[model samples]
Target: MSPLNMFSRLKNRKSSATASQHGSLPPIDKPMPSQCVSSPPVLPAATMHVKQSLQPAAVMQPKPATAAAPKPGSTDTVRSVVVHAKKLGSGAYGAVHLGTCYSTDGSVHCVAVKVISAERMRLESLSREASILKRLSRAGHPSAVRFYGWFSPGSKKVSTDATGPELTNLEVSHCLVMDRLSGGELFEYVLARKGLSEREAAPFLRQIAEGLAHAHSLGVAHRDLKLENVLISASPSGDDICKVCDFGLAYRYEVDGSGKVLKGRPLTETCGSKSYAAPEVLEGRGYDGFDADVWSCGICLFAMLAGFFPLDEATGADWRFERVKLATQHRQSATRTIFSFYDRPCQLSSQVVDMIDGMILVQPNRRLKTEDVLQSMWVIDDTIKADYADEYMYDEAPRYRGQAGSFDPNAVSGYGGQQDMAPLYRGAPAGVIAAPPPLMKQLAVLGQ
Candidate 1:
C-alpha cells in the first residue's frame, strides 16, 4: 500500500479505539511470536541495579522502591509499575499514561508507560525499538529517553461462555516504560510562544543535534524525528533539558559481528510523518536514512523559529518536491523567497540561514550531517555567547511564558500572507516566484 494510505489506516485504527479503557487489555505475559523472541535481547535487568552506571552521578536518580534483591532467574523484577488511568497521549500503535514504579523495598519512581495491544504489534519494529533504547540507555546519552524496560504478559487460554473447545486465548498487551516528561511536547511549547527567536531556540536545537549525533554515531536512524516526539524535562532551577523519545520507528542500519553499531545499509521505506519527510523520501525512492533525518531536523528548526512549517502540504500537490526543484533551479531566489516568509525581514542571521540551507539541501549527499550541524558557526556562536542563558537555564513555566492569560493564537500576525499564491510556481525557469500557502492549514491537518 502507499505510505499515505497505510499511515491513514493506522491513524484511524488508533483514533477509533475506546478511550475509557485506554490501556486496559489482557496481559501479554506469554511468549511473544518467534520473530520478537529472536530479536536482539535487551540489557539484563541486573544492569539496572547499578544506578551510577545508568546516568551521571550528578543527575538525581529515581528513588528506589525496596531493599530486597530479586530471585535469580525469576520474572525480571526490580520494580512494580502501575499505569494510571489518566491518558498522557495516544498514537498509531498505542497509548501512554502517567505511571509510577515501586522498588521492592518501597521507593517510587515516576514513569510513562506506552501500552500496545497484541493486535497492533508491529513485533519486529517494536523489538528493534526496545533494543535501540537499551543501547542508548547503556551509552548514557543525556538527550535520549531512559529505557527502564518493557513487559509482555504470558499467553493464557480463556473460555467464552464456558463451553467451546476451551481454546480462546486472551490477546496480550505490551508495555514500554520510560521517564515521564512533565514539560510536554515541543511543538505545543513553541506554538504557545507564537514563535521562538533564534537565540531562544538555539539551546534546544543544540540538545536535539547532540542526541541525533549520538544516535547516528551508533548507526541508528530515528525515522520519525518531529516536534511531538521531543519531550522536555524541567529541572527545579527551571532549565529545560531535551529528551528525544518514541523509538518505535527507529532503524539500526549498521552493527559489528558482536552486534555493535557500524555504518550499514541504505533504507527504502517511505515512512515517517509526511510534513517533515525529506524530498527524496517523499519521492518514494530509496534514500539515505541519516540524511533524511537531517532534513527533518531542518524542518523542525524552521518551525521552532517561524512558528509554522516551512513547506506545508497545502502549498500544492508535491509541494516540498516542487519547492526543492525550484530551489535547485534558482538557489538565491529561492532563499530570498523563504526568507520573506519570516515575521521580520532580516531577522534570521546569515549563519542560521546557511546552516538551514545545508541541512535542507535537495541532494541528500550534499546535506549537512548531524556532526557538521553541531560544528556550524551559528551553533558554535550560540553555545559560546549563551546570550539566551536566562531563557534556557531559568524561565519558570517556560512553555507558558507567552501563552498565559493574554495570549491569542488567532491574533498572531506576520503569517498566512502567502495563502493566496495559487499555482505556487510558474514555468519561468530563470527565477519563478510565488508565495507558498499559510502554515495554519498544516497545523490544522496535524491536529486532526
Candidate 2:
C-alpha cells in the first residue's frame, strides 16, 4: 500500500513539471496570487481563459495598437520615455544623456534627456523652461534650441546615466527631452577655431541677435547667456546656426500687450555667469534684464572677434573690468577702454567698437536694446538674416508627415495637455550665421 501511494505521488509531480516546461504558467483553474494588480501591465497568457466555443475568433485575440484602439499607457498616451544610452554633459543639478524615444506614430528618434534632481533644483525650474520653450517652439524659432517634453520618473531605481543628489521621493526626474544639438557647444566651437574673423563672426552674432530679439519680443530674458549655454546646430541648408539653450535661469518679464518688456519694474535677481553679468547685476542692484542681456551680447561679440574674453569678470575687483568701468564712467570710447588691457589686440573696426560700447555701457538707462541689436551695423547692414525655422514641436511623435508653410498652433505640444517635445530634422536654415554644420536640418526656412 505504501509503495503504491509513493509511486502515484512521484508520477503526478513529474507530469506537472513537464506541462510547465513549455512555459512558466499556473494551471487554468489556479492562477497565481500576483495576477491581481490592475494598474501595472500583466501577461496576456496569464489573463487568457478558454472562451465559449461559439464565440467569434476576433474576441479571442488581442487587437493591434493604433489610434483607433490603443491599450492603456500606450504610445498614444503622454509618456516620459527615455532609453539611456550615453552621457552627454552634466551640471550642478544633474546630467544630460542621449536617449531613444518611441513616438506615437511608431517612429523612433534620438532625444537629449536632461536628468535633474528635485533636491538640487525645483520642479518649477524645469516647468518654467518647458513653458518658455513651448512658446518659442510654437513659433519655430530657428535661433533657439527646441525643447521636448519633461518628465519626473518617480522610480526608486537609479537610472544607468542618472547622476545628481540622491533621489528625493525615491525617484529621479528628467528635466526635459530635447533635440540633440549635434554641432556641440558654442565655447567648444569657437575654441576649436581659436576665434573667428569679423566677417566669419558676424553671421553668428546676427543669428544670436535674431534669437534674442524673438525672446525679447516675447518678454523673456535669458539670464544665463554664456558661450557654454549656446549651442551650434546645422539647418537643412548645411550651414551651422547658433541656437540659444539652457533656459533654467531664464526670466519672464512683465510685458505690454505687444510682448515687449515694460520699463520701471526692474529685475532684482543677480543671476548669470559672472563674466557675462552686467555691472548692475554684480553690484546687486535692480536692473532691466533686457538691458543686461544686451551687455552680455556685447561681451560675446568681443570674445568671438578677438578669440579671447574681453575681461575675466565684469566686477570692479577684476582690474581689467575696472579699467573698462573707469573708462565707461569717464565717457571714454569703447576702443581705448576695452583694448587698453591687451598688449596687442586685433584690429576691430570702429563699427564693431561702437556696437560693443552701445550695449556694454556702464549705465543700464542707456544700454542697447535687443531690437536695436538686429539693426546694428553688422547685422541689418550684413547680408544675412535669420529666417523662421518651423517644425511640429508638440506632436505625440515626430511629425515626419511634412508640414509646409506657417506653423499650425493646432499641432503644438501645448495642445491636448501634451508635454513639449520636437525631433531634430534637416530643415532649410536661413538668416545670419554660418559654421561647420551639425544635427537636424529639419527647420523650415520661412520668408526666405
Candidate 3:
C-alpha cells in the first residue's frame, strides 16, 4: 500500500488533527518543468517494518468545475486583480482564490488572493496573522512564505467558492496578496513521493528548523506546525525546499517570567492538532508555545523518515501514544530508549529515534529545542553544518557575530542560539540559560 493508504490506516480514519480545516482547491494548470521539485532518490526500506518505496505518486486531481461558470458579466475584481473561481483553500481567516494580478509595471502575475470578510471571520485574528506574515516577509527569511502585502478592499465583491451563492459575491473587508506557490502543501508532496528517505528528509528538516528558529527569534511561535502547513517551493537553483506557512495560531508571546524565557508564558488556550499537540498544551496547564512547537516538529520528522505516523493521537488513551511515553520515561536516556512503534517494530537508525525522543517527551521542560534538533546526526550534514553553532536567526542585517567572546552567545544572539529561551520573550543575553547557578561554586553544584 502507498503511504497515503498506510497513513489512513494509522489514523484509523480520523480526520487529520489540524488547527484549521483547509478546503481543497480546484486544480490549476501545472507549472513548467523548471518549477517541479525533482523526486528524491528511492532508498531501500526492506529492513524496516513498512514499505518505504511507495510507487505511483498520488496527485490531487481537481474535480470538474461544477460551480457556476465564470462569466464575462461577473465583476469578480478585487482591487486590480481578477479573482477566478479556482480556490486554493479556505479557513476562518479568509477564502483564498487563484487570481491574475495586473501590475503597475504591466507585468501579469499569478497570485493567491486571501479575502477576509469582517462578518464571516474575526478581523483581529486575521490582522494578527497578516502582520506576522508581513514582518517575516520583510525579514526575507527564505523558509517562511513571502507576503506581497494586504489592503482593505472597500465593498469589493469576491467569490467565496464556485459552488454556492451564499459564498459568492462576498463583500471583501480586506484582502491579502501572496506568492502563488506552484508546489502545494508538503502533505500532498509526501503523498506523491510516498515517503522520503532519511537523506531526502534531512534537507527539508533543516529548512524547517531555519523557519522555526527565525520565527522563534522574532517572538512568533507557529502553534500549528503540521505537514499541512508546510509547502514545497522550487529554488532559483531548481532544488525543492520546504517553506513554513500558516501562522493563524502563531503566538506573539510573553517573555517576562524567569521560567517563561526557557519555555514561554504558560499558554492558556490549548491549540494545535491533537496528533501533534504537546501533552502540556493538551492538558491546558499553562504550557509554553515554543516547547509545543518542537513537539509538532518531531511528528513532522517521523512522517518523513518513517513514512507513517508514530501515533494516532498523542494522548494516553491511544496504546501507541502510551507506548512512546513508556519508552521515554523508562529508558535511561535518549540514546537507550527504543520504541515498539505503532503497528510495526521500528527499524529507523538509533540516532533519529533519539532525536525524536528528545523532542516528543511528555514533559515540556525537557523537550529539545530547534537547535538541539539541528544537532542531530540524522538532520545535520556538511550542507547545514555551519548552522550547528550559527545564530543567523537572531542576527540583524549585515552583522555576523555568533562567535565566542566574554559573553554567552545565546543571550547575545537574542534566543536564537539556545533550544529554550523565553518567547514573547526574546533570547536572553548570552549563556544565561546555560550559565551555572549564581552564588554556587562549580564543585558544590556538582555535589562536591
Candidate 4:
C-alpha cells in the first residue's frame, strides 16, 4: 500500500472511533488495512528533568573552555565572564561576558552574566522574560535556559563618578545572570558551514525537535522559535544538548474542563521576528502560540535546508518588509502570502517537504504538531544518528585575547560583530505580559 492509502485508512479508523464515541457509526466506503508504524515517544512528565549530558548527534565534541563562571554579585558577572581572556560581549538592553568563578572553598565553575538596564526591566516584554526565566528555572525545563537569578549591582551604594551619568553609578543597573550556552546560536554554526547538506542538517534538526518535544510535554510554547533564539548547548554530544533559549516570548497553557480554549495570560501584542511568523498570525486571525511555534520550526527547517526566509519575496526591494513590519507591530493584522519566498527551487526530499508543507499550513487547524514533525520520514533514517559520529561539534572561531581587569570593546565577538550590542533604547514596559493578538486568542498549538 502507498503512504497516502495508509494515511487515509488511519484517518478513516480515527473518524470511525469518533463516531462510535458519539453513539453512532458513520460508515466508511471501504475497509482499511491495519498497520503498525511507530511513533516517537511522548515527552516525559512535567516534573521530570532531562539528563544533562543529552547533546545533538551532529556535534562531535565539547566547545572550547573559554566560557566563564558567574561572578559573586558583580555587574560583570554575566556580562563579562572571562575564564582566561576577555570573552566578553553585549546585546540590546544588556552586556555579556565570559568568566570563571572560583568559590571560597576552592570549587570552580563557568557561567555567563547578562546586564540589563533597570529602565528596560520596567518594560512589560523584558519583565515577562524575567518572569519566564524564573518560572522555567523553577520548573527545571530542560529545553529552557538555566537562569541563575537577577541582581542589581548599583542599587546598594550610590557611587556615581565615571564622568557620565550613564557610566557613573553602575550599581543602579539590574542584571540577569543566566547559564550561557557556549555553543552560541545554531544559525552561526549552520552559516559557518556555508549552509548544510540534507545529510548534515537532519541530525541537527532532530536535536532541536527533541528539545521542543520536551517543552511541549511540559505545556510550554516557545513562540519565538527562530534560529537566533535556538542556542546550541556547550556539550560534546550535540543531538540531546540543544537549548531552546529566550522563553521571554513563550507562554504556558492550562486546559479547562471543556478542553476547548486555553486559559492563561492572553498575549495582546504579536511577538517574534516577522519572517518566521505563522500564516494565521499574519492574517490577523486568532492563533495559538504552540501552533505558531511549530510553524516557525518548520520555517527554521526550511531555512536550514534552503538558506532563506520561507515567506520572503523573490525579487523586490523591501516588498515584504512593510507587510512584515505591520504584521509584527499591529498584533491583529498579519498579512497572508500564497507561497514560500525562495530564490531557487525547493530541494528537500519528498517526505521532508511533505512535513514542511504540513507545518506551513495557513490554517492553524491543519498544521502539524511537534510530535508529528518529529516523526517525519527523514527523522526515522538510521544514517542521521550514525552520521553524528563524524561532525565537528566545537569549531571555535578566532580568539579575542585581552588584558585582565581592563575593558576592551574591540576584542570580543558580539552577536552581529565587534561592538554589535543591542542599542540602548527605551522598550516596552516591564512586569506586564501583553495579551496575545486576536488571532492568537485561543491556545491553538498546545495539542499538536
Candidate 5:
C-alpha cells in the first residue's frame, strides 16, 4: 500500500486494536534483510492463539475543542504557518497529530503536534510528561524522544487562516512539535506484518535493551515502553534506528520523595496504561517506576512471542485480586502456563522461556532490571546486523554549502520552561502504596 494510504488506514483503525485483533496465524519467521540487522527479528509460534486479551481498554480520546476555537484579536500576531494537521492517535494526555510545517526559511518539516485543551490539559496534564521529555533531552539519552519545542498560547503563532470572525480558527492551543515518526509504531508494524521471527526480533530487542539499560543508568524510568512508544527514524546515512518516545509518565529515580531537583521540580501523578501497568501500580500500590517499566517490557516481550498477554485479568474486582494474587504466589506455575500456551515456539538454542520467566515474575523484586534483562543472553546477538527499510526519508543538507542548523537545539526549552504549575497534591506523594515485601525483594534481585 502507498505510504499515504497506510497513514489513512492507521487513522481510521487506530482507535480499535484492529491491527492484530483477528485470529492469530503461525508466527512469521523470516530472517531480516542483511542491511537491517539492527532491526529486531520475530519468533515463530508453534500454534497461534487468536483470542484477544487485555488490549488497551483506554484509547486516547481528544478533548472537545474548546466551546469555540480561540478568538483572534489584533493582539493575536499569528504567524499563520501553513501546517497540515491530522490526528495521529490519542491517549489520556490528548490527541497527537501529524502536521507538515511550512516555514519562511523555505524548509518544509513534518512534525507531530500534541493538542491538549485547557480542561484535558488540567486533567491528564502534560506537565509531568513535558518535564520527563526535557530531562531526557538534556541527558542526550538516545532512548527518549528528542524535544524540539512547543507552540502554545503566548507563542509567536497567531492563527492558521483568516475566516469567519476568525472564530473556527482551530487555534493551535499549545501544540507540541516533534520529529515526525514515518515508520509509525513497532506494534502496528508487527501487527500488519507478522512479528519478526525469534532470529529477526533479536537485534531490535538488543537495541531496546541497550536503550533501556542506558535510561536506567541515568536513573530514569520510562514507565511506559510498549511497541507504540518505539519509533523508527532515519540516520544521516539513511538507515533506520529505533528511538523511544512518550515520556508523559516517566519517573526520575534520583529525585527525592519530593519532585524538586537541581534543575527543577518534576510533575508527578499516578498515571499509566492499564494493560502494560505493573501489578503494583494497578492495585494502587506504590512501586518503583524503573522496576515497573521493566515488568511492562517483559509483558511486551511475552506478548510478542506468545501473541497474547501471558496472564489474563479475572472478571470481577475480587476475582481480579485473586488472579493477581495467585499469579504472584506461584511464579513458576505462571511461567509454565505461558510456556505451554505458545504452540509453535521459537526453536531456541537455549532456555529462552527462562528469560521471560524472570521478567514477569509475580514479585516485582524478582523481576529483571533493564540492564540485567539486556544481558539475559536471549536479546543479544553479536553477529546480527539489521537492515531496516528506510521509512522517514529526509533530504541531506549540503556539506560546505552554507547550510545552517534549521532548529535551535536549545533555543526553546520545550518542557523545562518554568511555569507556575501548581502541585496536584502535597504529601508522601499520593498513591505511594508500598509493594509487597516479597515483591520488593524480587524486584531488587531482578535489578541486581
Candidate 6:
C-alpha cells in the first residue's frame, strides 16, 4: 500500500472512536497559540525516575516593533521585492508564498517569503527568529537553509478583507525571505517512501546530525526538531539532502562573548511537537535546549527507520512513559520490545539500536550529545562513509568566537582530524561498553 494510504488507515484507526463522538478531526488550518510557558530546572542525571508537574503556559505579549539602525551584514532593506500569489503552506504564524527579489543592478532571484500576520506574532519573536536565521546563514553549514532578508509591508499595501484587494496588495506584518527548497518537507518524503532501510536512512540522518552539531557548536538549539520542519532538497539520485528550517522555536543557548562560552539564561518555554519532545520537556522541567534537540533527533531517526513513531500518544497512552515503565519492569526485554514495536525485527543492526538507545535515553544528562552522535557507529558506518568524508560533512566555524553579528568564515578549518573506526561490528563485544546506569536503576525501582 502507498504510504499516504497506510498513514490514513493508521490515523483513522487511532481516531475512530474520538471521531464518532466529535464528528471529525478539527480543521488542519487551526492556529496554535503564539507562546507557551516553560518551567525552570534542568533535569539532573541523578533523578531519572521522578515525575514532575506540568507548568502553566507563559504567554509572551506582543511587543511593538522598534525603529533601529540595521546591523552590519543585515539585509533589513531591499530595493524592490514582489511576492507571488502561490501559497506554499500555512501555520500558526502565517503563510509562505513564492516571491521574486530585485537588486539595484536589476538582478532577480526567486525566494520563499514567509508572511506573518501582525496580530498573531509579536515583533520580538519575529526579530528573534530573524537573528537566528542570520546566525545560521553566517555559520554556512550546507544542510542549513539560506536566509535572504525580511521586510514588512506598509499600511497602504495591506487589506483586511479578501474582497478588498488581491494578495499582492495585502499588507503583511512581517515577511522573511529564504531560499526555496523545491523538494518539499521531509515528512512528505518519508510518506512517499513509506519506510527506509538502515542504509537508505543513514545519510539523511547524518546530514541532519551534522546540521544540528554545527548549530549547537554555535550555541543555537532547535527546540522543535521534527520531520515536518526539515526540508528535502531535489536530488536526482540517492538520498535527498535535508535542510533544517523553521526557526520559529529555535533559540541561542549561549552568548558570543570575547571567545568565552557564556550560557544565556535557560529557556523556560515549553513548546514543541509532543511526540518529538524530550521527556523532561513533557514533564515541564527546565531542560537543556541542546539535549532536548538530541532527543528529538532520536525520535526522528526512529520514525525514519520504523515508518512509525516508537511511541505514539494515539496508541491509547503516552508511549514514552509506558516505555519507561516497561523498561523499569524488565530493562533488556523492554528495550528489545520498544525496538521491535514496528514490524521488521531483523532489519535493524546492533549498532543502529545502540545509537538510538543512546540518543533517546530517559536521562537527559546521559543522552548522546550532537558531537557524540556524529561519531556514533551507526552514523559512521559504510552506508554514510563517503558523505561523512566530504569536506562539508562538518562545519568549520569556531563555536563561540567571532564579532557580534558577523562570522569569520575562515577562522577555523575542518573538524579536528579523527581516524575512521574499524569496520562495522554486529554489535559491541560484551563488556566493551557497560549498559547505562539509569536503566539499571529503573529496573531496580520497579522490582521493589
* TM-score, cand. 2: 0.63
lDDT: the better of candidates 5 and 6:
6
Lowest summed lDDT across 10 adjacent residues in model 3 is found at 439-448
- Best lDDT among the predictions, by candidate number: 1
List ranges where model 5 is wrong by over 4 Å: 1-82, 101-108, 158-172, 236-239, 253-270, 313-336, 339-351, 382-448
The residue-by-residue lDDT of candidate 4 on 1-448, one tens digit each, is 2121222322332232111001111223432211100111111211211112222344332221121323334332232322222334544454555545434455555666555566644544455555556656666766667675555555331122234333332455665556777778777766565345567667667767776766655555676677766777655654435677766556555534553334343333344555566755544334577778888887777666544344431112223333333332332112121111111123334445555556665556666777666665556654322232122221212122223223244433421133222221112122211110100001112210
Best by TM-score: 1
Q: Which tens-of-lDDT digit does each residue in 272-339 have in candidate 3?
A: 66556777766655666778899889878876654445544566544445444544444432222222
Candidate 4 deviant stretches above 4 angstroms: 1-91, 101-106, 123-127, 138-142, 153-170, 237-240, 254-261, 264-267, 313-345, 383-448
lDDT of all predictions, in order shown?
A: 0.55, 0.53, 0.53, 0.46, 0.44, 0.55
TM-score of each: 0.66, 0.63, 0.62, 0.56, 0.57, 0.65
Q: Is candidate 1 or candidate 6 better by TM-score?
A: 1
Better of 4 and 5 by TM-score: 5
Error of 3 at 238 (Å): 1.6
Ranking by TM-score: 1, 6, 2, 3, 5, 4
Give lDDT tens digits, candidate 5, residues 380-409. Answer: 433322222111001110001111212221
The CA lDDT at 180 in model 5 is: 77
Check candidate 3 and list the clashing pairs. Answer: 253-424, 261-421, 261-422, 408-430, 411-428, 411-429, 411-430, 412-430, 414-427, 415-427
What's the candidate order when arranged by decreasing lDDT? 1, 6, 2, 3, 4, 5
Q: Which runs in model 6 stand beyond 4 Å of their true positions?
A: 1-78, 155-169, 235-239, 258-260, 313-320, 328-330, 333-335, 339-346, 383-448
In candidate 6, what residue range of length 10 has the lowest lDDT sum? Answer: 439-448
Q: TM-score for candidate 4, please give it.
A: 0.56
Instruction: Go through the candidates in order and give the clash count of each.
Output: 17, 15, 10, 58, 39, 3
